[model samples]
Target chain A: MKIKTFLAFVGPSVLAMVGLIAVPLIGVVYLSFHSSYVKTEIVEVKSSVPLFGGLTKTTVEKVPQPVLDENGEPVKVWEYVGGRNFDTVADPGGLVAAVSKDRSTTEDGQPTSFRQRMDGLYRDVTDIDFWGALEFTLLYAFITTPCILVLGFLLAVLVNSVVQWIRGPLIFATLLPFIITPVVGSLSIYWLFLDNALVASLLEQFGAGKIYFLKDAISIRTLIVLYGVWHVTPFAFVILYAGLQTVPQDALQAAMVDGATYWQRIRYIIIPHLRALFSFIILIHLMDAYRIFEPVLVFGSNLFANSLQYLTYYILNFEDNYYKAAASAILTVIGICILLLPVLRRTYREQKGVA
Target chain B: MAMTRDEKFWEGMRWAGFGATFLFMAFPIFWMILTSFKVARDAYSTKVFFSPTLNNFISIFQDPYNFGPLLFNSVVVSFSTVAVAIPAATCAAYAFSRYQFKGKNALMVSVLSSQFVPPVVVVLPFFILFKNLHLLDTRLALVILNLSFVLPFAVWMIKGFIDALPPDIESAAVVDGCNRFQVLRHITLPLIMPGVVTSAVFGFIQSWNEFLFALILTNQKAVTLTVGLMGLHTDKGILWEHMAAASMLIMIPIFAISFTIREYFISGLTMGAVK
Candidate 1:
């Protein structure tokens, strides 16, 4: 192909991505450096008003921006704080420094105990809320990825085994969770356990007392993971089932002719055949689950069970701290990158081996 | 044919598992649809059967929760995204499928990995830019952002289809003195029509169901249906019936579309990884 033709073909999508995705990504990294804080600086501004009879009035209004102080000064400022925004959520050294700065205020101030120092540090720098979300984010990613993989693979095998006539209906039914909107899907699961809901009533009848699924952190976390699996497994199933189609018929038939049990055949043949698909699924899940947000939004309140995505969002939405939100957003990217390294390394090695 | 005891036992177990899977998948959506048809009082209770009324659907559309605009926004944004993305993606996909260029693998990986970046990271910049341009709450801004998402997947997916198609016909067309563009128009496009439709449908679904972009980019005027469901919250508590009604409206069209393209679901989703 001519270079011009190639560019013509590839240019629009690339430009769209660069303008929309790449530039914005660079913006997040750039915004992470400058801290938004209240600063007091006097500034002047021009103003204009349309008066009666098509006349215009222009005046310098004393617009006291929040970065400026009282004397018609700006009170808020975008201070270039370097990585200080990152220290708010992470930065143990910064936490210690914050504690040391406030040691005099630590409970009577006479050689504060370790616990007191830690508590003070938590207050000063370590946002427990963000850390809590980080913890749950990891937990959700690990727990739900495995659950969805297992269920999806299982369901795919079952669906393939079913009578051919029913396959279409079965596939549509299985994909329902995936097709439903994520927020609404999570709400459906949450609503199932609502007071006087069918599941709640059934649990009572089953001698397990009506459990308040939402209020209890453990149950809510489980509910969120369950909902994740319910929503994502279908995608995995579709992928894995497609992989299964590529399984060598001769090999399967040979194994079937022998006395190999179903489980044995799956373990020895199907699993190995699915190794590439498994890796792809893992990469997708890790990339997705590390940035978990919708479940937290729909199932758990940001007050208690925020994901890392939610943590960044809370910083932006409530605190309106763009710099801090950027820092958190960058941190989230790093977390996902860390999770992605092993899978990427494996793919690289496989490519080299192929070469 | 005489079945052994072991075979009979396995048959029952398999059917049981299938039944369980089916119920698990279908029940939540079934409940959503069922609840939307119930009256306010009966909606709350765990009653097996409630007098079905079409009131929830009618009420939500009429009153404060005017979903007509939201639905229109969704349709416009989704269809527009597909319209722009499909052709652009097909071009890129054709390039990837036909040519072996420098940095081709890297470019493909870049497309794949774009999916990994959290929407929050991307939304952050778009929000500021849109605010600066006074384009916030505009469907145009939403469409512009939606392109970033739909383009990559569409490119990769259509590339899969074009790759699977034999190059023999195109080569013959070239031998007949047809240029690349003519060959693409007369042969390549007609051949890849199913793949195009599949990519278009997949892109539409992704754009339609996208929540964060819709939630953040647009507000009252340009609310898409997914985030519009969240707006149904009232001061007292969640208006469950109305939300159910709204949820159904958002999902039923997706269900119809998905069922129509059920055969492509596996291939379109996997982007030809399995095939």
Candidate 2:
């Protein structure tokens, strides 16, 4: 194919991506360094105050008036702030103070030990909004990745080992949690744990105490993690299930002939064959779990736990700070790149080999 | 082959695991569907047996809760995004598959990396741009934004399919005096139609279930079904029954579409990462 034909074929897609994705990403980076606000100016206004019958007094007051455009909408002015937004979001100064304070002594006036100092630093950094969100986001990623992988592998193995007649229905049933909208899926889980809902009522009948599942931070976070596992396990199962098909039966048969137990054969043969897929699932899961937004919203757990994505969104919507949101957005992107660095390097090496 | 006593035990355990897994996975969806048909009181209660009602579904489409427009918006936005993404992706995928060009690997890598970009980062700049252009809360804005993620996915998935094909037919057509476009339309496309449909359904699912972009980019006029779920939160508190009904509206189509393409679902999701 000629270069012209190739260009023509890929032109629209390339253009759309550049215009929407590449350009917007660049704009986010640029906006991170700048601040925008509705331009306002101080102006004097005169008002007549009615006195007792026909008498009136004039008063002059100064007020700030938003500078409006031809369309009567407030005009916005953008000025470079040079990382002020980043400073506000990160609070490095406060972090330093907190660390230094913790390093000095305990409340009993005893000298702080190395372990205590490190603990203090951890607590201090996480108290900051940026670090706090990052901590939970990483926690979600770390916790859910292993759970999804193990459960998904087990599921794949089970589904694979099942009789042919029941496989179709099993796969169809399993795909429901995954195929449902994230919001709806989370909502479904959320409802079950409500005070009067099925799960809660069942627990009540079994003499378990009435626990307000959404009332506390711990339970809410647990629900979020549970939702992640329930939703994503199918993805891992499907991929690993596909990988299972390619596993050589001779290897398994050989192990069986050697008097290997089921666990032993799996540990030696199946896991080794699916090693590449394990990393693949981990890589994708890490990228997705880091975002972790819809569940946070659906669970109404933003107050208790916020992901990096949610932090940026909260700043933009609740705080009405686009500059700060942009700064955090850039930081979120950086965080993902760092999280994905090892997997990406491996993938790059493989691609090079294939090429 | 005869199983040992231990093997029988393991076999029983596997069946038990399968049953447990099936129940754990299916119970939530079953509960949701059941709740959608129940009255508000029954939905709130733990009683499994109750007289079911369709009133929740009817009420969602009526006054105040008027989901009719939101449903319309979701359909239009999802269909429009897929309609635009599929053709462009097909062309790009064909080019990448057949042609060896300069900077091809770099371009492909960029396309692949773009998928990992969190939507919040993408939406920030778009929100500002749309606000400036008065395009916020419009379906056009959504269709355009959805393309950013959808088109790249479509390209990768479609490219995987095209690469898998023998390409002898397309080459033969090209040699027999059919132009590149003619050959692509007549030969290559017909062969890759299944793959293209899978990508289309996958893209549609992405758009239909998209929450953040729909949340941030739209307010009322263009709210998609996923974002429309938030409206179920009333001043009186969340109407659980109505929410279940709304959820049904959001997921039923997705479940149907995905079930149809279940065979290719994994391949589509992995987007050429796996075979």
Candidate 3:
């Protein structure tokens, strides 16, 4: 009887969890292996080049003709077999006929392996643009995390210590960045940083050159980091500020009575008390910062010196290579899991102690 | 006894630090709002102070992509999510708070860990799933997704608040022939109203500001303000004055809702952290 009740209660939560979360993640992993291609209706074999600002067309006699059915319609001309390039076209019969026969061997006449043949049929996943994107994403996350944390902590402390009348407005104001959609926020930042815009103009007036905020590589990266900090700091501030409120006043007073300076009080009384909160915020921020997309997309990915997150978007949207994007996402997820395991374990222990 | 020079100096330093921190935190937002009122040429120019105009505001309203629908979508998603999530979460929170069930700790831990799952990772799958289910490009899709995200948070946060409430009140009600349902509806619900409101506000704001999931899941029919704002950039090359206007319009309601229930948001954060 007890077993029945236990199963009944656990059943829905488990079902919802699997249905909502697990299935989709598994589906993404599955789709990575499959290849999608654009099929052309007509198989026209022609080559063209321009000569002195004029058009030229050439029809090559060596081009392999398409197989036809009884209806005189062309059949499948290309099969994406999987690998480095999608140049190896196979005929319907799977025979090493005209196209393969001629282009199959080098001048030395060494026979190519079936693996090599197949490898030539598809674009290599590793050689795709996803790797550069992955690198940029990691760097972006690493740089933005500490800036948001320290700044947010300082802001949280400031808000918490303010007078009652001003505190409400101040807290709300600090949260404004967070409340605005990242798309809008990124656009706002882009405008503010434009070469002849408010920020650049002010810089130029102070003997600074026309600061191309989003044009060059280093400047773009700096702007992205700044944009990330601007967008996410409010979240960290809100979480830490709440943590501050829960800190036992008695402990703070005792520390003060012990002749501890403000810094000493913060170091001893505050930081230790907020350790769990800090970890929690950091973990959340890490997960968020790693998956950054909208901002990069809005800012224009081409402008960045190195854009990790934008690269992911480009791989997914532009290249349409789900395999590489999926692989990259999986790698990101693994990195996050590895970093978070220790934090999760600690949080688990703390929860257990409290319970 | 008069204060020493050293004490005065320390006090002055603290004040200076406080002032600097406040300015650092508040300036960007103030500037954003200030820029929203600036004309296109002025907004683009390097000048800090200029005559503010209502042209951006006038154009935003007159523009085909009216902010109204997006704002409406945000409200619908936020409120609907809270309405659905709170009741569902209340039930779950009650079961966890009242019952000494097996795997309770594990269940609680799972709920807490769910918060860490990046929305990006789930978005693609959810997009495909929603497409299959015919829920893609609908407000219902966002509401349901928001519920899933908000429900766990609601459950965990409300559980903390409920657990803090003395069990003696419920025990007495039970002794007086009140069934579990009656006790919860009449007794438990009233006592935890503030906590419920807090959870609702958090859920609402979270749903309101949610971008990645909304961006991926919905297109024209159910696009929220966040996604719509993204469209502005993608469609129009980054028009600073227009974007600033759109941003201010979107931020107004979020500011109002968050500040109105400011205490609850603070308490919700602490409850989430401490737990």
Candidate 4:
């Protein structure tokens, strides 16, 4: 009786998720293999004479090519030849024939050629552009994660010491950077740092030439890292600030009473207590950073500085290569899974009470 | 008795450190707002504290393809996503919190893990799915996609909120001959109202600020503010003044929401995952 009730309750949600989420997810997997094709249909009219020389007509038929392939061979094929409208047939002893070609079949009516089965899974995993984008994505994530963590920790520590009256406004001010959309954020950075702008102007004042933020590979990469750090650090700060608030005051007092230095108290009392929040924030940021798209797209709006995420966007939007884009996206998912494996495993075990 | 000079010196250093940190954190936003009011020429000048002008604001609004529709799109998609997501999540969350059932733990974990799935991973597949369904380029398509991200977080948050509520209140209603629907409407919903609001606000902000999905799923009619901002960086040059105006527009709603529900936003960030 309990089992039936549970099934009834869970059934709809499971079905909805499967139908809306899982089926499309599966379709993405399917589309990664099959090439997207466009089909055009044309009809031709023909005229012929009946046996009694009375007027009769027949519709000529032609199929351009196979719609679907079987074992990598065209299951249906057609031969089409061009001619002037009814001119050849009007001439004496003129004839028209529609022919078909099956490349897999030999002249002796034997299937001599071997065709390979469609390996969608293998192709989805092995696309070249996908791998390049994967590498760039990892590098971006790795570089930015630590920067945000350290900067956030430092900011949180500083905020923790502010007077009660000022803390509220100060906290909100610090959070403003993160509240804006990343698209705007990256554009702002681009405007500031692009050639002859504020950053370039400042550099030029110091005897430096105008800096092209997105021109060179190294600078563009650097810009992306900086942008990622700038955009994401506020999120880390918010989480760390909350975590800092929860640190036991008594423990800090005890450490101070033991004549430990400020840094020492932070290292032992504050850091240890904030481990779960730190891990949670880090995991979230890492996953988010790995999929860095908008900033890269906004800042590196051009051909160069295309990070893996941006590359995926370029492929999907510019190239219109859905199969390759799907491959890249799949790789990105795998990269995130690998990065998050430790935290996910820990959560799984804790939930299951296995450790 | 002697006063220690070292202690005073360290206190002074702490104050200096805080001032520097505050300045660092606050300057970008200060600059953003400052640039929004400057004329195009004055914006490029390095001199500080110039007379401010409203030219940027005027230009942003007077222009044909200004921030108007993009802002409207953001508002519509965000609120629509929140409206759909919150109710669906509330139902699922209530079941998870109140009922003890098989696959309960698994379902929760799956929902949580969905948050970890990179948006890039789903974009391509979702693009194909939407295209096949003829949902591409529609506002409804964006709302549906946003829900996938927003719904999980909403569910997790509402579940946490519901878990914090006392079950005895509902039990009393049950004892008074209330059916499940009546008890939920009269008792549970009212009790967890704050949680619902918090979840809705969070979902709205997330969907509003979400750029990746919006950049991919939307074009032309449904072009959101975020994607529209990207247009500022064309081949001609980066339009700092116009971009700043747009940035200011996007930040206003999010800042308002964050400030209003400051405590709930903090709690919602940590949610059940941390504590």
The candidate that achieves the highest lDDT relative to the unseen native structure: 2
Candidate 1's C-alpha runs over 4 A off are A36-39, A42-79, A91-127, A205-207, A348-355
Per-residue accuracy of model 3 over A1-355 as CA lDDT, tens digit each? 1345434534554556566566656765565444554433445666766666585767744444556768786663333334322111111222323224443564589877767655553223212344345455677788888888898888888777768798777777677777665676776676677768777888888998777776666677788788888888888888888788888999989988988998998998899988888888777777777667776776665544334445544555566555555544555566678767887888778777777
Off by over 4 Å in 3: A1-14, A33-128, A156-166, A245-259, A302-312, A321-324, B1-9, B46-51, B132-135, B234-236
Report every candidate's CA lDDT: 0.83, 0.88, 0.71, 0.72
The fraction of reference A/B contacts recovered in model 3 reads 0.40
Query: Which one wins by DockQ: 3 or 4?
Result: 4
Could you estimate the TM-score for every candidate? 0.89, 0.94, 0.79, 0.81
**Per-residue lDDT of A59-137 in model 1, one digit per residue for the tens?**
9856554553468655555667888888876766754566567564445557877787676665554346666677788
Fnat across every predicted model, in order:
0.72, 0.72, 0.40, 0.44
Clashes of each: 15, 0, 3, 1
Clashing pairs in 3: A83-A122, A136-A308, A137-A308
The sequence of per-residue lDDT tens digits that candidate 1 reaches over residues B1-275 is 99999999999999999889878888888888888898888787777687888888898778788889889999999999999999889888887778776666667777877877888999898888899999999999889888888998898888888888888879888889897778777899998888889989989999998988888778789999998888877897787888889988988888889888888765678774574
Per-residue lDDT for A186-232 in model 2, tens only? 99899888777888888888999786788888888998899899999
Provide the lowest-lDDT 10-residue window in model 4 chain B: B21-30
Residue A350 shift from truth in candidate 3, angstroms: 0.8
- Scored against the true structure, residue A89 in model 4 reaches a CA lDDT of 15
After superposition, candidate 2 runs with Cα above 4 Å error: A38-76, A103-123, B1-4
